[model samples]
Target: MLGLLQRCLVRQGQRSLHSGRPALMAVSSDSGVGTTQNLSESDIHQDIDKRVKKSKVVVFMKGTKEQPQCGFSNAVVQIFRMHGVDDFDTVNVLQNEGIRQGIKTYSKWPTIPQVFLDGEFIGGCDIMIQMHRSGELGETLRKAGIESQISDPPAAKDTTEETTPSTSSTNVKS
Candidate 1:
């Protein structure tokens, strides 16, 4: 049954994690049936390439942009939202096991919630957080032809009112 296969896949993933190998999960083919197949590396690469180029900004996360399934994914979504990037493409890796693993292989990064700007890998959640804090993310988005909503802090204002000193005011000796 599918449940048994899923359990086996989970155990396999756990074993791969402990064995220092990339985890691999089985995914159904595009046939829309319950049948599954082993995707060739080239096929996965092609699929990932198409997805990366689907938009100016692409995110491979655990869930959709509207509803993230994990904290890291949510963080990625929030970072984009902060940048006023709402039209970016999002691939829910949780819905496709092949993509979930294939993305890691494609980017050579061992994590989920991978971000791509202009079809280039930009790293994952931690990297995104670092870029967001360092203001690099906004700049990067700008360079990618995508403007960010975050703006520079306003200059400090002088609160003191400009007024002529009264002649009657005596200067105090310090």
Candidate 2:
């Protein structure tokens, strides 16, 4: 009997997971209310978990690359810059109503500006700076086969400068 009750409760929670409503221990008074009425914590957690594991480098911040909503987020960007990162992905948790809360649960880090490298949770802004200072960041990049901008100059700029001829002319017609 106890097992049957537990299964029923689980089903109810799953049904309400995506409805944007809090999961209740007791059944709602209205049986007409459907799962669409509310979303459970499990739904939010699943959303965050899928994103964290989806990319090689993922930054869960307050804002996107163009605009960071918090000082901590900006600091994370700067640290990545120092390490010469040419490509990375950012998730603006502030924009997502669910992600802002979900990410904390997913990472169990209790903070925004979380950084992940090669699908592994690295840490937040402070950790990033510390790793860069210790030179571990560069080593990690190499191990992941991720080329850093610090190690290699911009190829396009270098090639252009090399191919372009000098505009100034020293030769004079007599």
Candidate 3:
């Protein structure tokens, strides 16, 4: 009975995973929501790989950095801005049907605003948020040679001299 219940639960989870909400690109009417023919997987992978390798920071997003079409993408743009990162390159996935869908498969990440650092797939908005909040994002950028304008100051050194142990002992009243 327990095994049967587990199987049913797994089926429900899979159904939800397959039935995720579609990404709204807010593209021009002419584009008509993925009307462009899809490209071969190998071609798409090659293109994305080249783009990632070519740029120090590459973001596969729904729109350009100047004009992000989705809120999630916009949040990512803002995060980069906060870190004073402006040299990054962004692919407007909304412009092409092949890449729009192919990118998700390429990254195995089911979301837009995918961040790639030094040809490495970092993650999506949530992961970036966590990294920024934990101060790791700035460090990562510095290592990549992108100096952050709002970088954290170096940790302060301890300067106070150690105090000697108390020489006198207090007596307790009976």
Best by lDDT: 3
The predicted structure with the larger TM-score, 2 or 3, is 3
| Ordering by TM-score | 3, 1, 2
Poorly placed runs, candidate 3 (over 4 Å): 1-38, 153-174
lDDT of 3 by residue, 37-145 (tens): 4657787777788888988998988767786666667767778887889888888787876877888998999988899999999999889877777678888898988
Expressed as tens digits, the lDDT of each residue in 1-174 for candidate 2 is 224434543553455565565432222222121332245678766655666677678888765655555556766776666666747788776445466676777778888889888778899877876666566776788888876554533234446676888888888889
* Candidate achieving higher lDDT, 2 or 3: 3
The 10-residue segment of model 3 with minimum total lDDT is 27-36
Tens-digit per-residue lDDT, 1-174, candidate 1: 224434543654455567663333333333221211267767877878887886788888866777565567777787787778898878778666777788899999999999999989999988987887777888899998888998743455675644655667687999
lDDT of all predictions: 0.73, 0.64, 0.74
Off by over 4 Å in 2: 1-39, 151-174
Tell me the deviation in Å of residue 138 in model 3.
0.2
Which residue pairs collide in model 1, if any?
none
| Cα-lDDT of candidate 2 | 0.64
- For candidate 2, what's the RMSD? 18.5
